[model samples]
Target: MKNHQNPRRTFLKNAALSGALATLTSGVSLASSPSKRAVRRDFNLNYAPHFGMFKNHAGDDFVDQINFMAEQGFPALEDNGLMKRSLDDQKRIGAALEKNGMTMGVFVIDPGFNWKVALTTGKEEYKEAFVKECEKAVEVAKIVNAKWMTVVPGYFERNLPLDQQTAHIIDAYRMGAEVFEPHGLTMVMEPLSDNPHLYLRHSNQAYMICKAVDSPAVKILYDIYHMQRNEGNLIANMELCWEEIAYIQIGDNPGRKEPGTGEINYQNVFKWIDEKGFKGISGMEHGNASPGKEGEQALINAYHKADSFK
Candidate 1:
């Protein structure tokens, strides 16, 4: 008998191996079988999720996460720390967002670092620092193609009256607005959660400051999570300050996690936003209550569930 095997047998063995390899390479397994139900949902506006929120599922790379967010149908993405990123990183991020058709939301520029005092202090040194930071923020905004940036006026100066502090914040913002206006950028001021020490802790306070600033380049950030913590009437306060609000941030209170993780009824809130015809990005500046890829999927699902309301 010849040592060579039968041609048909050899062909059969090779065909079976190829089939197995195809299934393995295509990620088809019993666990990966398609389910009858849809696993994801969609939202109407630009619902922005922050960087690193989906790292485990989307890999450590920022561009990879951006791509994943786009694939998963998130209309926008926000990086609060965009200014901290390198110029190259910012350009790359901007390019990725453009490619994925994702909108870039606010990036942190000042973040409440004694800005109220600096602007209000009447001290030239502090004012200069504030202005310098504003100038840098303008450049960063251009790099990332960001239209808005987050600003906080910091805590109130005890020696100063509330009105004085407010006036100072307005002055600081006016100067800051000048820097951004030239570049078509807006500074979205966020009122801190009521700490008793912070100056602008209430939506009304932020609203007043925005009015005082009196410029389109200056507006409120309207973070729902912090506002819900400081003041319970989410919709009413939002309505009261609606004109000044340029941007919005979302995170459930108590846990500061995705929408369904806390007591606030996000479904109703989202409905109200939709009804009001607010056409801006809602930054998801919260953390995942759970861990790993499961946590990421949960966050996605939570948004879907909350946004399911008309």
Candidate 2:
């Protein structure tokens, strides 16, 4: 299932590692070295790193972090908290990403997502509030050149029946879609696994809602870490709802850190998705395996190892 997506990138990586005087171990380490400056070796897939993921290497400034990601050859960037940043900061991030030729991944559309009385309650006030959020997200998306925003159905209204709650979710999302469709934007529904009390907890349920909503602007965010926690059969479940997925997020379970720090074999998952022809970004929505600059290098090395799937 290996994908030769970029031959020049392959050539660059191979050349950088093929120096005749190099030892086997140094060649491997040099690919993602911890030096202040490392040679750019583009990842096979568009794996994105978020802010603070590489702060020790890039300093605390956000734009500087973007520069460091570009230097390390990240193909995209995702910031869940982008909507809350000031207008100047957003424009600077947008310009930095554009300068680096990186794609903007999903941002949480409604940062104030209520966990108490979610959309499942069939409350007009809640739906109306979400529509306003959608309007606001549209403006935010424009600032970052983002096409997708993350959405979630809040907690289940335990008093109501299941079917009624499901209907309410579809109706509300349909309204959100109406606002985004004209602007060529999509709302990617995220199914989280923080706790059992949350309503949108499964891929099939999110898939059903997206299908029911029946809009191009409505789709699934598909966070692998949460999906693995909520349902263990990752590949099978992904296949069942592949078409409805618009964006993908990456995080290994148990530690919610880099790939090899947990049980999930991300190499296999990356290979499968590449084989499936997914050209979108995979948000690195996890923390470094360790602390500080050394940990940052470990994160880079882990992705290099996982992306080496064949």
Candidate 3:
């Protein structure tokens, strides 16, 4: 009896091996082979990798992870829960970034992912509380040498009219803007597609609020994953909201993983972004598609594939 065959799987493994071997021999920047590190080179776009993306390869230490990202050619780092980190940790990460010459990308305005008081409720108290959080964010930003911070306007209130909710969001953000403006920092509001209850969920909606606030400190965080789920016309909508977009995040839909794991053609998207002369960060806001060190390598490979869309 003939042995069972897995030709497709075998072919994929062989192809990956070939790519790794080629990258190893070439004295050029590319995803590192598991046994050897890739030569560090400047990527066309400043792609930012988030914490835990390379943990298997870099180990559990935060600074080690950052150093690994820099070694792998990632020029920036973004952390979603940076506010939760202690002051010492923040300073440590900052020094590490300085050491690596890596730019600090967006961290959430506050570590609290959910708000007890919705910003869209049109309440003065909630607005005040959010403004205070923005103040805290400024100090955190200063410690980390960060310029952009992520903002989520909070839950959608069914009892209130859409206009009222938008108005409330604008009011709160304007106040938040005042806090960040003096420090030359930006509060980039992210529109999520995770639930129907999210107040900010579309590029145009964020654009509208930003225009009303009319502050340099307030802008849109065009997260490709959520936007892709909310609306399919990724490039067109991004183009429409281009000016208001200050920071960008990446996650492929169907699974909030690396770029090539799902429907988003990140290559074309990245190519378009590069053409527009965007000097800001394109954050890797997604999880690794696979597990362990192999998964980390795959994430690096995905970015290389996406970044090659020139």
Task: State model 2's lDDT.
Answer: 0.82
RMSD of each candidate relative to the true structure: 19.6, 10.5, 15.1
Task: Encode model 2's per-residue lDDT on 49-121: one tens digit a residue.
Answer: 9999999999999889998998888867899899899999999998777666566878886736565896898
Off by over 4 Å in 3: 1-40, 111-117
Alpha-carbon runs more than 4 Å astray in model 1:
1-41, 111-117
If ranked by lDDT, best first, what sequence of candidates would result? 2, 3, 1
Kindly provide the TM-score of model 3 when superposed on the true structure, using C-alpha atoms: 0.85
Q: Model 2: residues >4 Å from true position, as ranges?
A: 1-41, 111-113
Q: Which of the numbered candidates is closest to the native, going by highest lDDT?
A: 2
Model 3, residue 232: distance off in Å is: 1.2
Per-residue lDDT, model 2, residue 126, is 88
Clash count for candidate 1 is 0
lDDT: worst 10-residue window of model 1 = 23-32
The sequence of per-residue lDDT tens digits that candidate 3 reaches over residues 251-298 is 998899998899889899999999997878889888889999899888
TM-score per candidate, in order?
0.84, 0.86, 0.85
lDDT of 3 at 150: 92
